[model samples]
Target chain A: MEPLTLDEKIRILTESARYDVSCSSSGSSRSNRKGGIGNAAASGICHSWSADGRCVSLLKILLTNHCIYDCAYCLNRRSNDIRRVALTPDEVAELTINFYRRNYIEGLFLSTGVVRTPDYTMELLIETVRKLREEHRFNGYIHLKLVPGADPLLVERAGRLVDRVSINLELPTRESLALLAPDKSREAILLPMRQVSGLITARRDEGRRAPPFVPAGQSTQVIIGASPESDLRIMTISEQLYQRMGLKRVYYSAYVPVTGDTRLPALNSLPLLLREHRLYQADWLLRFYGFTAYELLEADAPNLDPELDPKTGWALRHRQLFPVEVNRAEYEVLLRVPGIGVRSAKRIVRSRRVQRLRLEELARLGVVMKRARYFLTADGMTSGEADLSSERLKALLLPEKKKRSGPEQLSLFPTNDSDLSALTGEL
Target chain B: MAIWRYDGSFTGFLTLCAALLSQGEEPEEIISAEPLQNDLFRTIISVASDENRGEKMLAAIASRISPDSCRLLWQAFLSEAPGVELLLWRYLSFGRTTGVKCDRFLAHPAVGPVHRLANSVGQEAHRLMGIIRFQETAGGQWYALVEPAYQVLELIAPHFAARCSDMNWLIHDRRRSLAVAWNKQEWRLTRFDAQGVPPLSADEKAWSTIWRGYFAAIAIPERANLRLQQQHLPHRFRKYLTELEKPPRR
Candidate 1:
């Protein structure tokens, strides 16, 4: 067999990296220094979107596809019969710079399979970013994946050079981790995450004059549906990670079957994309909407409602919270309304200070009144539907099926229609 | 009724706005002179572009309204939307009379249209930041072409300048015949002419092919939704994107 060329290496490596879906390039403010090649935007930029509707923000690729352990769900597990290749540190650095020059990507997302040993792979990953930053003077957004159980010194060094770092807690529970990946331990993953979190806080405590250390902060990915954890358990774990470890994001990658192992879901099993989308919505509510995990889910109804959004479902479950007048509600109260997002809630609060808001003016303030109309009142008038049952309101809010003549006309505003659903991970 | 006309530049519009406010005249319409159309029963006042008047208008708005509102006015001017001149005129006049409190009144009749128009322009510029693709030319410079609905070259230039500071690149807005060129250190905006595709080096061609291949390989087969793809990356941006371009026939 012929050895893989640079092109083949990228094709295989990127194919493997595509499954771990943390493509955000924002939240870091790495500015361009004198003689440096690039800078990071505080609100990260997306360079492209793939056919799958996932964001292609970074040049996501792996250092190698060869692994020492066989994770049952991973495509690049050791037992899988697939082409294996690795790029040298210089090669990876050069590829990133060249791609950046052509504006194909914002920066590099360098994750690797366990090759030789965890420390060995960690050193190689660190070397690639170091060469890009110090040798080539490239200062773009670099998201380095931490090799579990690697030295904390190397992880700290990595934090200094790259804008963000992540370690994948692929499964929610330790029992699931033990069942699927015998080589990887729950402790191995959390130890590095804790270290990175502490380092980020320490650097932040030092005033603005101190250099940034992982300015974008640390994030981790958990595989949904591959393990048997319910949405309630998943959100609980995510909330804990956010509060305890100070994670920036907990990405939910709907488990796409890549191997035929008996321990894993059957190859014919569908990817739980809808479930993943619901989890992300709940996650957003947790992070921004001032909603707690228990508020969104309970032990009796552990799973998210597939037909309605998590917010709407929560509104239905708690009926007494509705009918909050838009004009009189506080900022937090307005945020709890079904239709109002964080932006619209802020806008509603701001606009009402000048004059009382009218129902007709809600759309101008960025409120998605389609869902909010049922939950709130404008001035003294109800949204024209008074004291409706929760079941009737839920029926109205559910997305209508097409009438079979033809698919409905696509919206001219890309952000309002299908693209927004994909971008926000909203169902 | 009086109709005011001026050069289509932002400064010219500001000057026209200043003249309207100082004269205590309420114009029926504020139109740019380049595409000037005659209005029956209205006196057309041709206002010259005055730098001092423009500066005064900007300063007054910044002092009275919030700096953020002033930015919104600037962005609205760049939108080139029909009747935006009149919209900004009304917004500024309203802001002047109402003081700093006017900025928060998003639903105000004079302010809402200008805010929406400015928001659309900002959204277009943000979209182009992601969809604008560059191809390496034989001369060692990276070139990209965009045809945004708004005059977004000024808005997007600073972003590319900071992100690709070391490399020389040119982003041409073919619809407006304008281009922004960044030469390692500083960037400048100049008029540009449309030309044929420039020749590419062998390595660039190979990398482009590999990129397209990676793009195709990564998409999940079960979740192929062209409607969603078109929604995120509209049809207008595909002409110059190398990965979206069809490969030449063998």
Candidate 2:
């Protein structure tokens, strides 16, 4: 294969990388300077704090776009007509170091399709990362993709070198795997994820502080709408992954139908971006917002409300829980408030230790009072005539027209709570 | 109204804050000026900066606001944000009556400006954190240059210290004319002339070879949203970036 120009490789790998949603870079010890190695700031990476509170944002990319597998939802599927390019191990390493040098990227997010075999592809990724860390002494954020069905030793060695590792589950169930992605199976992906998670767990318990294996931790991506699964089913699988398997993130990518396979749904062209978005919101509630999957997808609300966010919808449905006292609400009660995020709730709890806060004080503590005001009572004052019935509360909260007419920001992944500009611009 | 004035610099501001604590007065008035030439006929007690008084005052005011202000206030002031000084003073005064506060200022319209400024500081720190490209140095160390809008030297250094804990690294911010260097397990901030930044590693060819290769390998072509990429990773930032190695088209 001919070597790709910088423009060509960027086109290929960035497109390939787009399907993965983990780009948070926070919580690490930061000390970016005037002119040193790396800046963990606007110059290098603008971090989006993830659900687990870990921050990551390497130059997330894949080594090649030439995939042998025909994952029906992916553009890189072998059946799809796309210009194919692959970077050599040296090319991958060189590009990462170059990106690292210019302060364009914090680290390398290197994933690749199976060029020949799982081992061959895995070996290339391992060597590329090894060369960067050992030969180039590139001590920065490196998240290597764990190819499903790669050698166990290769997977283990990858864990040792990179800051994080991800083996995407692509779809939820084996049935969906069989239907949409003929080349992929749940076993191939979950086996490696379970392996990496087990190793990460083992190293943590050693207590010797062995260079934290996957310090930023393991994450996976699941393409939404490719299979016939409900939000309940999708979240149920994600909940198990978080609790039973101990994964860092389970990215939900709205299926952008690039392939026309008879096995997949025709509606995939529009994909379920909103559904994927809602799932991410529900996922945030599950992880950091302390929501359970069953609770998020209640009996009446089987799927998320595409119009209102899951949290907002939950607040509307559970009107009986309105006007929870903010100054003295339990952490659980505080978490239930829409717009009062995990960070904001923690801030409210911590700040109360100083003084009994007023409704105005809630805003000062980072609460989006515009949304939270309808749901909470701060210092015995609520945003209502003490008599506005639950019906009126819903009307006040709903308003005849929506606040803004754009699609809701990603409420699902990392339950993204940054300025909406970060979501609409980056994604 | 006691206006405690100091030289127009962070150190000078801290120096005055330290002096204000000595009078045991909640200096309702704080101002930053570069030795304003005014011969006042009225009584103005020239507050002498006692050594211990200065350190204690500096700690008292700084400890109450945010370590982030050490990196943000100057930019906030430079932006000429209304009431930043007053808000910082207000925050300090109230923070004196505090327990785990600072996030509280996020919604305060008065302190809102400062909180917004801190958000920018965090944004800058994280942008540099992600965008900072590291070039390999001849001495087996990683080197990169940054040009943040503000003096964020103290804001983002520890990230590298923790991730690349063993290696020696430096991020030189050309805009602020400052640098953060991590060597022997410690990070130090120092001033440098931005105009005189030495050329990147006199012989820089071999260092970025592997890096350039890594950059070339990872991009997915079928999904090229250059408009979107340009929005977050703009073209103006390409000069020092290795992945964005080639000069962007005008």
Q: In model 2, which runs have C-alpha deviations exceeding 4 angstroms?
A: A1-10, A25-44, A47-56, A81-84, A267-271, A385-392, A399-427, B24-28, B34-53, B56-123, B131-149, B154-250
Residue-pair clashes per candidate = 1, 106
Clashes of 2: 106
Model 1's TM-score against the true structure:
0.95
Query: Against the true structure, whose DockQ is highest?
Result: 1
Q: Please, what are the lDDT tens digits per residue for candidate 1 over residues B195-245?
A: 766787667887788778777766765555576677677777787777789
Per-residue accuracy of model 2 over A1-427 as CA lDDT, tens digit each:
5775665666567667655766654322223333333323222344222221222356667788888788777778887887787777787777666555545456667888777878888999999988876776666667788888899999999988877788888888888888777787788888888888889789978886456577767888887777777899889999999998887678887665566677777663222655766777788789888888888786665778766778887887787877799888899899999879877888778767655778877876778877788888988988676456766666666625745564333223333254432442122
DockQ, per model, reads 0.57, 0.26
- Residues A117-208, candidate 1: write the lDDT tens digits: 88899999999999999999998899999999999999998899999999999999999999999889999999999999999889978999
Instruction: Give each model a TM-score.
Output: 0.95, 0.78
Give the Cα error of residue B179 in candidate 1, in Å: 1.1
Q: Whose lDDT is greatest here?
A: 1
